[model samples]
Structures are given as C-alpha cells and as structure tokens.
Target: MASGKKRGKKPEVEFRNTQLADALQTQDMAAVAFALRHGPTVVPLMRPGARDDPRDTGEVWTFRDPKTGQVALLLFSDALHKPEAMPKAVGLHSPEWLRAFLEVHGDEITTVFFDIAGPHPMQASPADLIAALDA
Candidate 1:
C-alpha cells in the first residue's frame, strides 16, 4: 500500500517537573526547596558560549533523585557562574565552572532562598525539605 503522508518522529520526552519549573520561574525559594525535596529528577541543559563572549543567561537545570530517578526542571534567571575564588580564565556560566563550584561548595548548599533584589527573604532547612520530599 502507498501512502502520501510522511511519518514524523515522536518528540523525545525530557522530564521537566512542572512544580519545580513553576517554582524556579517565580524565584520562590520556599517552593524551590519544596520541589527539590519532593519533585522528580532533572538535568541541566548545557549550552556553551563562544570564547570571545562566554556568558549564558537563563539556564535550565534538571534535578534527579539518584534512588527513585524522579526528574524536575529549574530555570535560573542568570547563567551559573564560578565561585569568587575561581579565576576569570575559567569560563563563566559554563558547566565546567558549575561542576567545580559544586565539588567545592556542594556540602555548604543545604537550603534554597530567594535573595535576588527583593524584600522578605525566605529560608528552609535542608533536613526538613528532604523529609518533606521523601514523604
């Protein structure tokens, strides 16, 4: 049988947690924390910039639980930057920079808070958030 219609490939399903996406989009630290605890797995979509201008803004990160394999997505207003201790030679907002930063500072990152040019700061404990997420 001959058919005129062309078949198209099905879109790949990349897990993007709606709850986490909403939280990050609004920059709601509390919500972000909540989602981190309870939401699905996620991975960052890495897009490198040119050598001359190497700043990438509006990065999206996907968080994934190692055990459950749940996925979630988070959007950052600005590109992820290297820690102050790092030299400028390290590309800013690059995945490599972020990996280095996390390797050094991952232990220190316990909670999520909204501190970007706004009043009324919010805080959440990692333990509590983890508990909530596990529940």
Candidate 2:
C-alpha cells in the first residue's frame, strides 16, 4: 500500500545561501503580485551581533514566514557603505520601507516574492510556518 502522503518528493530548500542571490536578481511585477494575492509573509530578523535580547532586535533585519515558521532575512540599509546603513527595524506601518525593501531583494527571492513586515501575516501554526519559511 502507498503511504497516505506522497513520497519520493524532492526535499525542500532551506537556507540555501548560494541560490539566494539568484532570486534577488530576477523579480517582476506579476511575481510580486502573486505573493500579495497569497498573503503577506516574512518578518525581518535582527542581526545576531546587533541585538542583545530578542526585544532589541531591529525591525528591518528579518522576515518571519507564516507557512514555514522560518524567519527569513530582511536587511535594512541606509548608506550601503556605512556600517550603520542597515535599515532601522520597521514594524507593519512602513509601507514605503516595504516597497524599497522588495526592490533591494529583487534578485534573490525565487520561491517567495514581495517583502513583508509586521507580525506574522496570519496565525501560523509552527509546522506551516516552518514549511513556508523553509521553502
């Protein structure tokens, strides 16, 4: 008998640094919209060296994925050269920031497109969050 769930599926990709740069360089309008239609996702994560405690985490640093429960990355930059250029951690209301951010990552995000902010866009379960974030 076959298993209830499908098997022989290719394993998911998570934290594949090499592939990241590619996603950022190939974004388009339709792709971005597809992400919005699905739902807002991802949360900015703080730079480990920058934050002391979790509360101190910056707003513009990471994105938490709802389906995968993984906190992808969102680096906010101010000067691009200056060390402090990292964007200040932004909460949900920063529409301008969100737009700019998506532009910056226009090449690296192959699977998920569009940048997200605020709290987890939905009340994501741990497993679901992991799946999406990890994907």
- Backbone N/Cα/C clashes per model: 13, 35
Give me the displacement of residue 64 in model 2, in angstroms: 12
- Model 1, which residues run further than 4 Å from truth? 1-8, 23-41, 45-108, 112-124
TM-score of each predicted structure versus truth: 0.30, 0.25
Candidate of highest TM-score: 1
lDDT of 2 by residue, 7-69 (tens): 688874232121222232354333333333233333333433243564442445544467875
TM-score for candidate 1, please give it: 0.30
Best by lDDT: 1
Task: Please give the distance, in angstroms, between residue 14's alpha carbon in candidate 1 and its true position after superposition.
Answer: 4.0
lDDT of 1 by residue, 3-100 (tens): 98889998964444455556766757567656655544332344434547545432333345588754322222222221223222221132344344
Relative to the true structure, how large is the alpha-carbon lDDT of every model?
0.41, 0.34
